[model samples]
Target: MPRAVRPDRSINAEDYQHAPRPVAAMPKDYAPGEEIAPHSHRRAQLLYAVSGVMRITAEEMPAGQAAARPKGIWIVPPQRAVWIPSGCEHEVRMVGPVQMRTLYVEPDAAPGLPAQCRVIEVSGLLRELILALMDEPLDYAPDSRGAAVARLLLQELVAVEALPLHLPQPRDVRLQAVCRQIEARIGEELPLEDIARDAGMSSRTLARLFRRETGIGFQQWRQQARLAEALARLAAGQPVGIVATDLGYAGTAAFTAMFRRSLGTTPSRYFETRAPSPAARGRSR
Candidate 1:
């Protein structure tokens, strides 16, 4: 099967070009089906999906000039939101109709929050408090109760440990070609011969490298990539048939069966279980 294709808005280099100072909020309401672009800000951010589900991918940039980095993280859930520290580059993809409420805080405030990347649970009360904070206006008095509530909300954000579902795309010349081909033709079934040719190696050599670098065989690694894509596409509310076709699956049932095998639940139920808190629902407007 091929990888899945999602309907994210095209992103440009300039989006991740400029960096802002660590501080507070950005007044932007992401639409149900939109891409937040690949960008990094001065302040660390807590990307909470107030309503619906969202897919987030984050990684560290190379030491110098770069296209895209190696290691990657894929996040999809309402109860769970990714912690992006200041200066770390990241991208956002909305799955379904997501009401994303991002709390961008200064570096000084970082001490109170998670020091590393993690998924924080947005409990009911905490969710309400965050939505209320968003409505209090950016210029709310420093000594106001609203500010206190906001501080409390930040403190209440408990980090949830999870398996590191990140894949490290190596910097080897052979691996680069294979990675690019896979990304470019996400909707096409990748043939072993083509991948081996692109990598400038025999099929046997390529398979060995995949296992060594990625800890999985070429086929398994591709499936993981496809699953990551599927999670992103399905979270965006794409039809199963459309997603299946995009991933080069034989049919929707085949794609669904694969999804079920990888994940414990079906796509619809998986998304349904990720519904945002009531406060998230209130902030949907």
Candidate 2:
């Protein structure tokens, strides 16, 4: 295929969404506490964080449904990316100074991609592929180096594993209200009975609704919510003691234990490691 004209790299995503290419990579930086307002994309997106963390909230609409419901919250740390399907309404909040490298893939260009939003692990090879593609022309020739990288990127994505860094939200208005309150008072130890009463439902009914709508029980959902918050705070360079205390953990040890149980690592160690270094990337290539 002949090369198409490339848009200005400094512009927003709207500039590249209509490009005549299977995949286009863009680099953007965000300051801590910056927020991208709610929006939708015509092409699917692989939002990768080279550093820092991103807290993304997306709305998922069932097939043939007119209205969309909150899917869940995903906490994306370094060396990880979130796959957002085409036309999915989503918003992002930066947990730290984020160096984001994103790829927008045409819907028909990549088959077998996930239909739902998910946080996926970005392997060393995939990371390098994304970085390399960022330096290529937007409309690279089909037989060019950029095209080769794009093909491998799509192949890697097909086999990428989804992470458990999601906190599912409920569809019911009453449950949504309860979830919002829980998120707001994440540091508080609110009793199930009191929360249910405030929502105008019995504890048993509230628990059932949580399980039915979110595929997780109330306590599990609460724990997941806490975990999501902790990841953001920790990624922002907060001390373990402070994050633990702010999130209602009794002590640093308890918080560390919880982090280990959920993510298989301590908070300090998780943020200590980052995307592969330049030397490592060279070796991989």
Candidate 3:
């Protein structure tokens, strides 16, 4: 069997952003902690990591309107991808050694593609399609094998389920400050009253504001923040016990319960089940 093509780390995705092809695949590897600075593209993007995890911050802008405020944060692990609409500014930080497979799709190529930024579950078929397209040239013939794969990939994108991996940011300055504190002290058990008082608002007002702005209660938002940090640390190879303790859980059992409730699996089992087979990894090389 032929060896899979190695990704050229030096290649820039921007160079092929305007290629004649409706879809272009870019494979890049990043070291742990490496970050892609804020930038936007003319084409929409599906950002997937075959291994490791990524935390992405993005802001969307409708056509002919000024850019909106930073919208939300998405924590994308293996088996999931974040869809970024055309002209949305975003930045990505790798939580571990990352093998990123991204598709840049022309906005008009697929009808009904999401207009807002979201995290979607990547099916195994879609993953394979993306990997196959990476083996083809960016400007392959319209009727070629690559084009067929790209068409199927776009179809899959429209059908994939969106995940609840988003952490929406609030526009209110007071809520933003409270959220920042919660994130900064993710491991601590922060009381709502204390946080509200610190932000110069009463507890009732704070709770209402949280629900109004983020669509979740204060504790729920805090747990989601903890979940994001826990995922990043776990992806970086931290032990379950350490992650649990660091996140202020009473014990591994408590942390595991929370993690399972939020993600449908324990920490150990979550990464274990999502890990690609050796053959699959080899094919995606």
Candidate 4:
């Protein structure tokens, strides 16, 4: 398979933020498998999934050494943006066709944004303002109303909170195979050794790779994966027992224990406590 080609995109941050040019718009029908490469910017970025879903991978670098392999950010529609702090190295992939909007904000305006990756709500007014800015002609006057609206858009962005959904990936083929197995048989319970064998590695090797890639051992990732799957089923009104059994747990009690350990809430309580899903933002919640 051909790897996605990262686009070589550049815009002068000073000119972009202060020149009063209208905001650039993203295409309505966007396809996945496009790469944005390993790049950094002085300006912070707000990546919004206007429709469909996207996956984001981020790496932390210190002193210019390449860090660990990137993990996952599963972004869907309704929630508008993923706030990336300045100087962070990240990559993006589309799960489906997505219509995404990206707002590059001034570095000074970034302090109020999320310190880490998160999902933020996009209100109707804010969304419209962003769209309108995109519609504005380039070379717009600095004193134009569009510039004022741009300022307001920045303010509204600060008020949005980042909701997190991180899924870790492994570099080792053994660990990668283990993860693939779990995803394939999500509805079945498989022994650890069996999973290791499928991955063509010993259980010990698999465990070590799991720690290296995901920062968690095999069992923990599995439990979290189970809980993640359960959350989706429950949101779809699946019965608790059915969800539990489907995930290969002994019963609802077993599933609840794992869910609480990972998410700090029981299955029943989590759904109740979480704010309602954004409009059309339904997934295995």
Candidate 5:
């Protein structure tokens, strides 16, 4: 995969607060598999995808200490944005042809927001606000309509709830080992005992560590990892059967049941509904 191309010096988060403009937006189109190398911003960011999925991995910290931050993965679909605190190192990969619209907020302007990286809902008002703000120059007059829009956008960001969809990274060497195995062969069948043994820990010991580190049992953590992986494969147009079999389900039927249980939608409808369907796009073409 190639990296994204951007002109001008990269800006940091704090600069947004002192600039003539307190908010900024940069719109771009990305091909599938395109990535941005690990980097950090001086300004906080709201990464909103107008039409595709973005796989974001930021440093995550343990449980309630997400505010402390270590690393986590956010599978951002349309109508959603990932809020990243200023100065957090992260990377992004486009899962499909992504029409991305990102908002960079001044931390001083939007205080009390999540300190860690996580997904936030993009409401209709917020969506239009982003479009409107994108048109203003970085130094727009503070008293102008653009300024009002910027302030309101900050307010809306504060009220939204964080989605419980991000995959938190485990820090312990033993816990990390099990997570790597689950992702390496997401669909392959492997007993927990076997996975624990590979990590040089008994099954019970590993399970305890998972709960302590990630705040979830081993099974739940693995399922979310599989879901995150499934989103990537499905967004890239993998077949339902292939994904199901790859994830370790018995068949398409069983795989879908777990998918629906985990994500609340069937695999066939998940990515398609996030954007226009092929048939719908065909008619437009």
Candidate 6:
């Protein structure tokens, strides 16, 4: 299903381009089904969801990026942020009621960060820094204490591990067909050859193209897709057994194991631990 766009006016590059300082933070609150139309930014963005879930869909990513780089529609759970590199076209939608706190960083300021988008784990200290910096002016002086905080935020971003909540999107028509098929019947494990045949290609050819376009093997990609679906359903308070069964797992244990392996936590535990705190509630300036 196509994601619902936000009824509010869309935010775009001009909103932050030529920011006076290296980093600028803004706060935004979104209702469920709210969305931003396709847009890009000159500055890289750390799209942090403080109170709710969001789904981000990118236009085709730039070339030569690795698998570790996130692509496609990313599910932003609480306490997590999606790092969008400079100049990448993407759209955003809030899955539930969302408190969005975004930090826009100049591309040149963060040298060691990922060139492509990925979901980064937000540490407690980093989260505090983001909140504190929200009060800082975009043109805050570089040598000021506020600038020091921004510097610390940059240090925190370096090599931050990516969460596997992103679903890789393939651009090729054949691979798009295969991915759509998997998403439509996500409850069943379609054989590789069958998927390939439906895409009008041999199994080997499909396998190669899938990885080339999406940065992971077909199996792993499908698994990620399932996990992504599982996240939205699980967040809706669906029962574990139902979610597991709906995602094509034979039983709850099988599904639980996959969830744990993929995210280092079980379904029940992930939701329990990730509830938003009140401090995350902030308004757009």
What's each prediction's clash count? Answer: 5, 0, 0, 3, 13, 1
TM-score head-to-head 2 vs 4, winner: 2
TM-score between model 1 and native:
0.63
lDDT, candidate 5, equals: 0.73
What's the TM for model 2? 0.88
RMSD of each: 8.4, 5.1, 2.8, 8.8, 6.0, 5.8
Q: List the residue pairs that clash in candidate 2.
A: none
Per-residue lDDT of candidate 1, residues 1-285 (tens digit): 321111221123233223232223332346666887776766667776655566666664422335655555565564556677666667777766665666666657535565555555556666666656555545556677667766776667533344333445665777867877886787788789878976678988988887876666777767777877776676656898999999989998898898888765687766665443333443223
Candidate number with greatest TM-score: 3
Alpha-carbon runs more than 4 Å astray in model 4: 1-25, 32-42, 60-70, 138-143, 170-177, 192-220, 223-285
Give the per-residue Cα lDDT of candidate 5 at 9: 16
Among all windows of 10 consecutive residues in model 4, the one with the lowest summed lDDT is: 2-11
How far does residue 284 in candidate 4 sit from its true spot (Å)?
Answer: 29
Runs of candidate 5 with Cα error greater than 4 angstroms are 1-18, 61-69, 251-257, 265-285
Alpha carbon lDDT at 38, candidate 3: 87
Ranked by TM-score, top first: 3, 2, 6, 5, 1, 4
lDDT scores in order: 0.62, 0.83, 0.82, 0.60, 0.73, 0.79
Top candidate (lDDT): 2
Residue 123, candidate 4: alpha-carbon lDDT = 68
Query: Which window of ten consecutive residues has the lowest lDDT sum in model 1?
Result: 2-11
Candidate 5 per-residue lDDT over residues 91-199, each given as its tens digit? 9998877767667766676677677788876776777787667656677787988799888988888888876578887778777777787888887768989998899
Q: Output the better candidate (3/6) by lDDT.
A: 3
What residue pairs clash in candidate 1, if any at all? Answer: 2-247, 95-235, 95-236, 96-235, 96-236
Off by over 4 Å in 2: 1-8, 62-68, 275-285
Better of 1 and 6 by TM-score: 6
TM-score of each: 0.63, 0.88, 0.90, 0.57, 0.80, 0.85
Report residue 55 deviation for candidate 1 (angstroms).
Answer: 6.1
Segments in model 3 whose C-alpha atoms lie over 4 Å from true places: 6-10, 60-67, 273-285
Candidate 6 clashes: the total is 1
